[model samples]
Target: MLNAKWKKMLVGSTVGAMLVVGAAGAAFAADAASPAKSEKHAAKHQAKLEQKAAAQGLTVQQLLDRQAARKAALEEKAKAAGLTMEQYKAQRQAEHQAKLEQAAAAKGLTVEQLKAQHKERHDKVVEQAKAAGLTVQQWKDRKKAEHEAKLEAKAQKKGITVEQLKAQLAAKKAAK
Candidate 1:
């Protein structure tokens, strides 16, 4: 009887240890699969800050700051036209708004209508992406392929075949 009891206890302990170890291993695996908890916290805070900045009309600096070059170009244009930079900016803004208004009027649309159309276009693109069953990177690759195919078709219409284009591209790549 004592031997049987000892055998039972040994089995129970072995099973219990295995269960504990399995639970711990699962926890460790989950932790490894996830981004660090602190990174998620930081990301949440950064998103909130970005939302606040957008609401407050604060512009983030782009990796490449085009503003200086844009300003210099505008100043040069203004000088050429015998107008101050400020005057040129105002004139351009007015012209841009006028063009927008004219386009809206021509389409029998309000500014809101134009915005809605733009949003619809964005939604359509998103829907197409979802329908494609591809990841974002994969979708981009597919788009590049489709664009190349369309370009090839156009070239074919102009008496240039895809094989010729591929050969030319290969030659150009080799030259580089």
Candidate 2:
């Protein structure tokens, strides 16, 4: 049998060890990176990039213009395959947005709910694109087709009809 003093000491030491382990676990949990910090890191890196560009006697806007020209040239290359630049941009955006919506819907957000919440962000991006001279209708058409294609692919992969998946998604959202 343990003596009273030894029993008390053992209990105290066990509690102290647990406290240390708990504190260490909390520290590890809090070690995740924040998006804002990452954004700041990127902004700082971009500033350094601009400094390099300036050393080459080029402004950031000039670099962007060059990139835009390259993109236009690529679009022309893609035209041989019957795709326009606007179509390509919209298709890419829509496919990505579709996947995001799929995941969000899987998490119980209704299509209407997701669209309503994201409409402002979408409008702001559209406004920015208009400011940058991209036509809204062209972008919308391409994006719609791409998103439809994504939904079709998802349906095919799951061995379900597109309408059935849509209904299931709707039902899931409604239950939530």
Candidate 3:
């Protein structure tokens, strides 16, 4: 069995893989729609990328480069593990599913029941966002902005820049 640290690393990598796959799926779906819709989706995605890059004090190209680099690194890791990319992804996914099953059993619920509960919570959040006249993405963006504002205020109180505060927090986390 893997140790706790290795398990955590695997889980984090699995989540990263999921996000990359999800984004690609979304882009593919958008392209499958009408040309106008595809253009709109592309514009929206670009805007999001710009926003994220700005938040990280990076240009859009720099952000894209980083994402490409991360993907290449993951691919290299899969190669080193004697697995193709697809095989590595499948293995990681199976591990993640097993962990979910264990968690559900510990909670006295089956995996299906746990999934239903999660879906219900997600639906509720979507409904809440709708009631606020915002799309789910918009709602999430608002919440993120609010969180950053609070962090900025706290950093100001400590007489540090937000970047400095974030670096300090990251260093502390790494030390742990």
Candidate 4:
């Protein structure tokens, strides 16, 4: 009965999602198809998708399907390991980050160079956030609390132990 309720909700929600996505796509296409579409918008859209496909060595559809499959597999693995979705995501992110570092080594770039680049981006975000009336550290702390609150709600809904959820959240926070 519980499973059926979830399946029903999922199926019903997907139809609404598809309609929203389809409407957005149609609007974008109509705007782009206009004779007056700025060259900048058209070129940006064209080049962005083409460049992404080339970088991933995949056709656009293939890339999308592969990403969806990877997400599904990750979710399945996380369930099997008794982890919440966010915990598994963080673990995969760390693994992929390590792989990127190894790839950078092959290109003769040092870890220090990567760290410098990361710091530059982080500093830019910090400046932007400060300009928007919040310090970067304050923004980050707020986001972290909101995320934890969301996970706590999910844990409660799933009848998970609060202590276990707290421990998991602590581990995740420490990892950051």
**Which candidate achieves the best TM-score against the true structure?**
3
Higher-ranked by TM-score: 1 or 2: 1
Report the lDDT tens digits of candidate 4 across residue range 1-176: 56988999999999999999999999998987775666768788768877677654567777678879998998899999899899988988899889878976976787778778779998887776667666565667777898888888988987897678888879999998
lDDT winner between 3 and 4, please give it.
3
Clashing pairs in 1: none
Q: lDDT per model, in order?
A: 0.77, 0.80, 0.91, 0.81
Provide TM-scores for the models: 0.40, 0.30, 0.41, 0.30
Clashing pairs in 3: none
- The TM-score, computed over Cα atoms with residue i paired to residue i, of candidate 1 is 0.40
Candidate 3 per-residue lDDT over residues 37-63, each given as its tens digit: 878899999999998886555789999
Q: Which stretches of candidate 3 lie over 4 Å from their true place?
A: 1-74, 144-176
**87-169 per-residue lDDT for model 1 (tens digits):** 98899999988887888887999977877897998677657766876444456668899989887887788788877877887
- The Cα RMSD of model 4 versus the native structure comes to 25.9
Ten contiguous residues minimizing lDDT sum, candidate 3: 50-59
Question: What TM-score would candidate 3 get against the native?
Answer: 0.41
Count of clashing residue pairs in every prediction:
0, 0, 0, 0
